[model samples]
Target: MSQDRTGAGLGVDRQREDCEALAARNGWQVVETYSDNDVSAYSGKLRKGYRRMLADLDEGRATIVIAWHTDRLHRSPTELEEYINLCEQRGVTTQTVQAGALDLATPGGRLVARMLGNVARHESEHKGERVARARMQKAKAGEWGGGIRPFGWGVPTGETTKKVDRRTGEETEVPVLDMDKGVPEEFAAIDTGHDILLAGGSLNSWVKWLADKGITSTQGNPIGTTEARDILLRPRNAGIAVYKGEEVGRGNWEAAVSEPKHRAVVAILKDPSRRTTPGSEPKWFGSLIYRCGRPGCTAYAYVTQSGGRRYPSYRCQTNHGGGRHAQKLDDYVQDVIVERLSRNDAQDLLLPGPGDVDVAALQAESEAIRRRLTDLAGLFGAGQITMAQFTEGSDTARAQLEGVNKQLGRAATQDPLVPLVGAPDVRKAWDAMELSQQRSVLRELLEVTLLPPRQGRMPDGGYFDYDAIQFRWLRGPEPYYAK
Candidate 1:
């Protein structure tokens, strides 16, 4: 078995050759070779090659194992003892090019192996600490620590300056990116995307624009919707250095977009209900609560387009079909809502009625259902349960879990807009808010209903009446009509 955590340069190949030479000199035939490249043995990372070698030894398939050094074979003392126990049981011996042979069959050999293991572990821990400290220092200094290329930036390459150590008379080359390493095309795209978002473009619109322009990710793959969103949210694209998820400070490189614009884009994306792609209609006022008002209808009205101009309206998905012009309806509804909240006792509207329904029991039920589903999955995987049984059980559990989750969501909904509605200038505060925020406020206030148009009257066109729009307040008395 041969293994190298970092397969940089010719180190792994040299180690392999050395192991082969040692085998040849000992007159032993190499039956199989196992290697795990770019894997770490000291970082609690799984070493596949090492595990495979242990399996081979356990099966009595290998009598001896050769490594470059003891550290290469083991770092943790616990791991060392486990391997030693395995070797002793299998009557297997270990040899290292640097530390000579280890005979697990003897007491002295075990002592030496444990001592070496401790030393290797101590060195590995200190080295890891040093590396972490160095990375933090680099982040604080606004210097890029080498890693995967960030979106909107190209591979960093620049000049190196030789600096001489006075006492030791030693010289070392220091690397630096005196000029920006960003690709002009990518930089421009980022700026364009930022501008589009600032100009009220949706995430869906931005991704479609990127696709139309043939803009791809750093790896030349077609940029995905989530990836595009992530690119816009990356702090590095805004010339900020982030370490361990927290923003450190401004970075050394030029920003692809301004900080303010970047923050705006972030705020927009943070809206949970914000649509990613352009919907059928450009305007979606009151989309948060627009519902079909037909008797016993439980369908949401979606945006539908018409003619050359886009018409924002909510049409039922079910056959109970009803629609309202988004602009006209919103205007009339907002006027009534503002009038209602503008009253002297408007602050009363923000008060909490009876306490929220406790979801503790429902949450416990959800967790229990999840555990049962996991157990079912295990039984199915082990062939203990038939496929049909597994499927039926999983589906039933999932449905129960979903119903519980929905109940929990309803229980957790609180009006964060209470403070805004209670403000002195409630309308001004509401107007300053984003559409999504406004929608949240509306959801807290009332349930909107869009009744189907009168018989034979088209739901579209300019002559739609105002009586179709209705609001049923959760706390206040009676529904408000947009007259």
Candidate 2:
């Protein structure tokens, strides 16, 4: 029996013809033939002819099965195993044009079949890896790997190699003019191959253009507005590969459009208010500077306003058993905290001193991981190890690399701000920072506290005692005041 299919490959047709000729030469009678057209071998989920062949094998109608190669029989391992089992049970013989014959009844033949199947599996895996790596490399080089060229462009055909014309000094590549049919009288003489009508166009315009052209995608589906926009925005069209959030440029492939061109289109698609929003009202100095100090307090630090701006205070949201509230006005409390922080040697407590991170140690660790990876690759290439061994070693090296990379990143970040921390002008810098930046600096510096309102009457007849504030300074409680 011969299982030949259309849309498989020219190889399959040639192999089928060879099989018939070989059968004639060997004087083997042709028992049956099966054909399946326009079927995808990648997805073996459905094939009417294949299903019928299996049924024929089960009923002993077919004793022999032949194809171009083992992959033609089955692509997946599980499906291949099932076919082998079926052949074994039915005592059917299997043959291939490229891989030769197999008799399931004989142990030696079965071993050869299994080996060949394993080889095919390995070949498929290797091919997939090669293709993926090639795509990645191409993307990094900034080439359009593969896909329909975007609007305003066309794939260069024969004799259209040169992008620019020598005589006219104009681009000679095929340009996508108005996607719409029925050329206007004015644009009739315009060379579309050189001029794209939709220049600096929006996505909506592209959508309308596609609709007017009556052009569908390769999938034969009508182009939608979203699909049109996606096609325009695709980085692949610009000769760049986007992998893991990184864009790599391919060198050899032509970009259908330029990056700035696509960015302009994207700008039109974005909402107008994307960059404009009302600013937030300024809060007290330490309004959100500290997390709640109370062990069980789930609430965060917040500012409250009362009496039409007469009072602005920072307090823990969960201060009084969830529902109870305490109000501390901004001017009254902030002035006191500022005075206390200014009078004390707060800079010593606020700035992180030297010896926070060792740069040399981090660099050494990073170099060590790179050395280990190199060593592992060398070992694998020297035939001293298997793929499994190499993978294990590489994984460990990568983890170590990640750890050192994080440390290096942190060290690099610290280098910029470390010197400013202990400078004499640190207080001036802190006061000059925006409110949000000031809050960030304070949160990094201090752990703050809110003391309860004091009860009446001091021995000295002073309304409030500054020393009795009872605030615990966790770090340097530096207070910044406006000049």
- The estimated TM-scores of all candidates read 0.60, 0.42
Alpha carbon lDDT at 174, candidate 2: 52
The all-Cα superposition gives candidate 2 an RMSD in Å to the true structure of 15.2
Candidate 1, residues 1-483, lDDT tens digits: the string is 223223342467688899999999999999888776556667678888889889988999989899889988888877898999998898999998889999889999999999999998898899888989899789867787775566666544666766555335466885643334677888888887776655444555667778889988867788867788889888788677778885556679878875545655676577677655644533465653677888998877766654443665556777445346667777777777777777776766765632564555764675578668768978998999999999999899888865664565444233545546557887786676555445555666767888756654445554776656667776565454434
lDDT against the true structure, each candidate:
0.71, 0.52
Candidate 2 ranges beyond 4 A from true positions: 1-9, 35-48, 155-206, 209-223, 236-239, 243-246, 250-483
Clashing pairs in 1: 204-276, 204-277
Steric collisions counted per model: 2, 11
Per-residue lDDT of candidate 2, residues 1-483 (tens digit): 123222234544566787787667667777776655445444455867777888899999877787767666766667667887899899888777767777767778767766776776777678778978888666555444554434433333334333444334465545443222222321221122111212212333344545566666545677665566566555544344565454433334445544333333344335373323334434455555434545566555676654354544445776441111223333334444344345435445534533566766765665566657767877998989999999999898788766654554343222222323455655464455444444443444434544443566656685443333334444544434322
Leading candidate by TM-score: 1
